[model samples]
Target: ITACYCFGALLLVVASICDLVSSIQLGQDSGAVLSRPANSSRIFYGVMFDAGSTGTRIHVYTFIQKDPEELPVLDNEMFHSIKPGLSAYADMPEMGGYTVRQLLKVAKKTVPRLEWKRTPLVLKATAGLRLLPSEKSQALLEQVQDVFDESPFFVPDDSVSIMNGTNEGILAWVTVNFLTGHLYAETRETVGILDLGGGSTQITFLPKSKKTIGSSPDDYIARIDMFNSTYELYTHRTCIKYLLCHVIHRPPYIIVLLYTPGLEWRVFKSSCLPKKFREEWSFGGLTYIVSGKPDGESYVGYKLCYQEVLKVVKDIVHQPYELKDTSVFYAFSYYFDRAVDAGLIDRTQGGMLEVRDFKKRAKEVCNKMSKYRPINPFLCMDMTYITCLLKDGFGFKENTVLQLTKKVNNVETSWALGATFNHFQNLKIHR
Candidate 1:
């Protein structure tokens, strides 16, 4: 609802959107919304928990109604996260519940007691839980749901669950575009989004070519009613293709999953690692023996790495799409982390770089692995994989500029706010 709370007509979104809710909590005193104090009753709170694979995070959003009939504002946000996500505690479900309860404390301290009952508390799980069997994932969700049930805040229906990957991408797209003020403009020429995660990667944008939209599969289009206008987003299709394609090898997908388990004793070697480097990496309750070629044929580095990752890039079915025509793109998660790890951009003040920048850096990191060593051995592979994904998988032009942002307007670049907005609209909550 960037252009407006544009989804008034979206409540009956689709058959798949049974539990969806709208995020808006407009005041009953809607008579000519004027600037009010921070303490005004119009100011409200939304509590969202991101039950990600690596960790669970809490985002306490403070929203204010500045223009009841126009754009909404996310005035401020209080954020916190802890490592070892709920999935890590899958065996001991109660421990997973403890994590949820701990994060709730942050919400408790942030939202006022008087408004606690009115605030919407939600938790949306990403791919981490999606990897688990349904029974295991359900146990974890049930554990968190127990915590929410006991909390003082208003828990909407199906407040905690494994989020659909399509919804996940859309919500993240909404978070970045909405915060950047792309939604408020008249042109509505919104930027596309690129997220390179372990199990999945998402590419989303408004198609400039009707042929592109028409050629796409039915699942490619997400038809949502926003205000009176309808939007058919093709993110779901792109994401599915990209994720499946990238799995041709382990390096691209495994290293990207910072939260998944790994084989302890396997000396997995890849051309993507610095040729002379070998190290033990541990995370998510497991260890991995990963190393570079160390000493192999000289024909090892970016070229070999690229060819290996290229298999995954081949999975995409394309039309002369508008990804490049969209002008700007936003890449986050591993894209930002690898960029920061490679010294391509600042961790705090994330900067923009062309899609080819990753290619150039990958060449440097891989070709001269013996000369230049990175702190993370996986850097070479990640950089190479990302380069291939953007240039080959998504079919982005070399000159296309990608804005890498970890946070927007001081709030973490998160999809929870969008989900909250979706929930807000879906619930049609009455104060």
Candidate 2:
């Protein structure tokens, strides 16, 4: 029995190495993400599939345990993403599974055949599936899980599901702080994270004062025991895209709109849109005709746009008291993408920006409606939304600096790493 157990643990180590070394497909064959020293005795791999609102991404991580008493050290990460998230296939369950199956090829091709049975496979869906009704989202999740079961990798029963919005923020906060070494350092000081997605946004931070948590809603405060310390994180989850649904259709259209609850006829109008712009967009398997007024040319700029979004954000968004005193944060996802689009930051390497910077860009983009490309009618609206969401919604000061980045240490600074860590954090298998 002891020999069999020892052999099983050894197999797990080799299986993990197969997945990690195999993820070197994207021109990183010569990179250090996969190379390990001769003295390293133990290695493991973790596979996580993030089904986001915009797309699905896979993160395969390899860690080496140098000492039995210490935590495993991260050695390499294999990352790849696909477009049209699982939500895009809410209606076609089998098609959604097909997308996961396609990405799974990378894993199968790389993971050694002998170790395939030992590697763990999991998928966590975000805003895309959250927006879906339970039945539809469950069907989509089941499809992906079925694909996992069909593969050679190990599939845990509680593998595929829609994550809670707050947990999403917390895990992202974990990813950034852990990568930056703040989580492991002696000082507990950690940076906050602002994640903006097409369908949703999450704000999470470790408060320096209890007043911040005391004054906020009960649900806003969450406790997490990580490593050896307990952390109380202040998190807020909001969906900007949910508000976008209202203005999805250009005003003065008499057409049936499709939604999860089924089709409903309604004329959606918003002051944020241009007065004469018509656009068609698709997200989460639904098509929307978004446009400005067909008849009138009205005033559209920062002032009016802020007020329009303020009505929806003001009372609902709880402001953290410590925000003004200490405001160190890392903003990513659509925040980085739009900042690049607006020329506020660099595309390859992200930079720092003040909350007022977004306002300045918003003014420039919103005032020049004609100069603004008709292809992205939402640029002005999106910029204005970020500005309002920060200043008016979260009560962030104008001078608050947000470090925008897409990757940290050559790995995506999203929640996937954090989720992977949570999945394979501590192991005590006898070997």
Candidate 3:
């Protein structure tokens, strides 16, 4: 019996060595190898997909094994994203389907050679798909599933699953914190996160605690005060229901008649204003008036000053025609008239309001607006939300660490999604 046991142990050791050899050989072919002890449990790779309103993002993470007493190292792993801007679908719903197809195509092309299969892919769709009509949303999901079915042609078999918003927020929070140097002890006392995207923004606040050292905490003391006092107001915007109604030309409309002679103003009127204000004040030709600083640097002081610019633009929708030449005047007037008739702008507000000196008015408005405190601090928290989330939510207790890896900034062009699918398909679960 003792001899038999010894033989069995020898066979097991040989099998382990063979597995390591195979992994090393595979790594050599792939140009990169993540080496670790055979019994290490701290190493893991997480691939996350963020389908935002404006685009889709795929992030790959590699967690390195570490001593229990030392901080764990996080490698960049990889990243990719897609951008069509949800606005493409606002006017035409069919464009959403096209956008998804394009996104899948790009995702398939970017996976690492070795990780083309066996990696787990987590997909989370945010504002864009969430705001789409029920029928459209269902169609979008079906299209995504179909694309996954066909992805094997480009890469190979892999697992893909959708993630809830909460999870996306959590993972994003983790990633951001890891990227930024915020995974330190002092800064971990309390942290706030704000994620701004083309369509909507997500805000999260996490308080500090030491209970999450060894195991996941069952209960976390939420910093509700931080959320209510700082985050809530900063992220408010017109609801989707209101935005959709405006786009479809429903009720509760306001119009603005412009007397200016430039097509540039139309672009501003059409694209700059919030959906609520756009619906409320359908702007006219004078909408593009270049009154306040032709260089676009006039309003810099106001609380959420960009929003003030939007409001100022909306206010000028319907104003008296000023430039010379009746033909020019008619062009401006005709466009303004059409805009109002099309339920784009409102034509009220006493006669044409004109500011003779734009620079002076800009200074005055900026001064007054600057006095209002910004709802959220724009500096430290600008791109720091993701970092805050990881540290607070995922119990990432580590000092600052910099990771270098391949990253795709333009998700729309790169095939990150497909690459992610292929990564998981090739993964070999050793445990």
Q: TM-score for every candidate vs. truth?
A: 0.82, 0.83, 0.40
lDDT of 2 by residue, 1-119 (tens): 45333333222222232222211112123343734545777665678899987689888776665434333556777888999889878899999999999998877765667767767
Query: How should the candidates be ordered by lDDT, best one leading?
Result: 2, 1, 3
Structure candidate 2, residue pairs in collision: none
Per-residue lDDT of 209 in model 1: 81
lDDT of 3 by residue, 112-192 (tens): 444434334445565556656766655655555565555442222333333444433333333333233343434343223
Whose TM-score is higher: candidate 1's or candidate 3's? Answer: 1
lDDT of 1 by residue, 155-274 (tens): 878788778888877877777766676654568767778777666677777777887788777777776554234567777534433232222223235442221134343346666766
After superposing candidate 2 on the true structure, give the runs of residues whose Cα lies further than 4 Å from its correct spot.
1-38, 240-265, 268-271, 280-290, 293-298, 425-431
* lDDT for position 138 in model 3: 59
Error of 1 at 220 (Å): 1.4
TM-score of the candidate numbered 1? 0.82
The candidate that wins on lDDT is: 2
The reply for model 3, stretches above 4 Å from the true place, is: 1-45, 62-72, 85-114, 152-171, 181-190, 197-201, 208-431
Q: Order the numbered candidates by TM-score, best leading.
A: 2, 1, 3
Model 1 worst lDDT run, 10 consecutive residues: 7-16
For model 3, what is the C-alpha lDDT against the true structure? 0.32
How many clashes does the backbone of model 2 have? 0
